[model samples]
Target: MINDSGTLAQSHLLIVDDSLDELRILKSLLDAHHFRLSVAFDGLQGYQRAQTLRPDLILMDVRMPKADGFSACRLLKANPQTRDIPVVFLSAAASPEERLTGLSIGGVDYVTKPFLAEEVLARVRIHLQLASRHMDTQEGAAEALDPDEVLLQAGIALIRSRLGETLTVDEIATRVGSYGKKLSAVFRERTGLTVFAFLREERLKTGRRWLADTDTSIQDVADQLCFQNAGNFATAFRERFGLTPTAYRKSVRAGRLIEA
Candidate 1:
């Protein structure tokens, strides 16, 4: 579980990829950033590792010899023990449709080949922060509520359940509105955040779980979170979380040592 401060404290990261070169590249990148990294060369091993280690995040390659990223992602998502862990797809297939398919099948993000180190770190940071927030919301006491607070909570739940799908404030308003302005004002007053802010925060929280626990790449994390590009994801992630994604992951892993 994560704390209110959005820190995992200490966490493990799993990296799964078929290509030794790619695995090394990712390992080196994450290592430079200070993550306590473990690696699996195939999908089956990756799945097994996840079942056993329950790492904070999984960075999975889309194409593998057996039990490809998609199938593995589906299996993990279906399994209650591992379902909450985030999976991001790292692949060379750079098409909108392909990216959508990745996101549709339980992937939180996608990253094409030829990624940048900074971009990768950024996405990782954003998703980790997001995961921390989700854990906080789940574990924290539900804030005291008024009638409007009830509606806002409902809206938040709806948004969380549909993170992979597209959503808009207007759509949310239509669904939750007894009256538009009154509900919106009450929601902001109670939460001290706009409806969209709440939604974005929720998305980021979901993204963070994947980042911290899954073996998915940072680019894939960005894709899963619906960021336009890796660069944008990194910027937003850094802005939200004080450290780079790599640094945050490292910190969590380091903290885990004391807990153990």
Candidate 2:
């Protein structure tokens, strides 16, 4: 997801705020400095854009509707793909407590509102330089994870957490902050399986584990895995593992183990 409009040397920054006037002022100022800028009008949009754009830095307002700067920064830091991007808080409040809160939540810097053009530019430059230097030092020793792989891991995590619930690939993708098409493409490219195919495999695997390790009934297992019914689950289980759920559980209890 490279910024196509900017050259490799240009720094890309995302500005997140509700104020159109503020966006205009910041865009004008940053544009003059030859920075590639993207804008989001609220915290939610800011988080989504940050995930997709992977900007080098973010300038976010503190008291935005939907999500504030602190909440957005927390989400960014929590995400493996977007965690490394630096965030700078832009706020009208100059209180020490507010600044402390911002810094504690992974903001790299804080710039007060009614920005002084020179100061803002200077801070942006310093943070960008620091990030570049850090990347340089880590280049050969540790490679950064591929962005697609990161997205795939995030999607897998969401899927595993919600296996008991009925979910489509599109819902999983959206929950992971990506589109269905892109997630499907990445899953196919990386795993040689569609997203739904992978989910189905995982469901069957879990069912096998439950059969062996738990005393749960076949009907309950099928229902929990979102299968249509015990009959459907039994068919799928037999197809996958050459044993029906009832037979599998009985075999396990009888000390005749089958490979999971």
Candidate 3:
């Protein structure tokens, strides 16, 4: 979908987050874009306004005091009245796994924190235009897939939510009441990955974040991501990003930018 010059004048946006600093940063950028704005500091209040106002777009924070962004998104997607509204997640949780989780649960876009203003504006404008077209489609015409696809998505979501634990595909299959081998096949078909491969990638992504964004010890980062030991974690981290965890952290702290 495309928009002309006056497209943004009629739009409304809802932003939900617990951090005043983050909200202010977004508001400063978005206010210049000239859309109507409403703010909520927690997920519950955010959801209430979503239901009442039915805004053109929503910008949600992943971590909040009340119901988190994922849960709130599920509610919006499941509701008939609000199901077509677009949601964009704003968070520091930047990783392939986190992005997948947000999209699977119905976010239209994901914006990583400390984000560039131009990128945020571009994404918000694109999703808003996309949602405008989506709402114009006839009811019940969105893509339809098997319930099994949903199950695989849910299993992955569980994995992302429990990154701190020693999770196995077998345990997840049991929890979701599916056989291990069948679930693995479903995962491969849907995501081009076996469950273990995806799990390892997600763990590495988490380890990288902790190294740069927190003052976590190498051993502690390994423990948090459920790596077997610090040695193994260092080996895997270096292989993935071509730097030891400590070097990566130091480079980031020194303002020499590197993508995680």
TM-score of 2: 0.53
Candidate 1 vs candidate 2, TM-score winner = 2
Error of 2 at 99 (Å): 25
Candidate 3 structure quality by residue, lDDT tens digits, 1-260: 33565366657899999999998888888888787789988766886688788898999998776567775676566455666789999998788987898897788889888889999888988888777776667666445435466557556766786788887777766544456898799889888999888888988988888888888899999988888899999999999989999889999999996885
TM-score of each: 0.51, 0.53, 0.53
Residue 46's lDDT in candidate 1: 83
By TM-score, how accurate is candidate 1?
A: 0.51
Q: Residue by residue across 1-260, what tens digits does model 2's lDDT show?
A: 12344233678999999999999999999999788889999887998899888888899898887667776776676576677788999889679988987887678999998889899988888887777666656533323466577678767766675689889877776655567899999999998999998898889999999989988899999999999999999999999999898888889899999884
lDDT of each: 0.69, 0.82, 0.80
lDDT tens per residue, model 1, 1-260: 34557554445678889998998899888887677788887776787688778887888887776556765665566455566677867888678987886787677889888888888777777776676666556653333334454556546555665666676666655443334575467668888887777767776666566767776777887787777766776676667765555655666667641111
Deviating ranges (above 4 Å) for candidate 3: 1-6, 139-260
Name the runs in model 2 displaced over 4 angstroms.
1-143
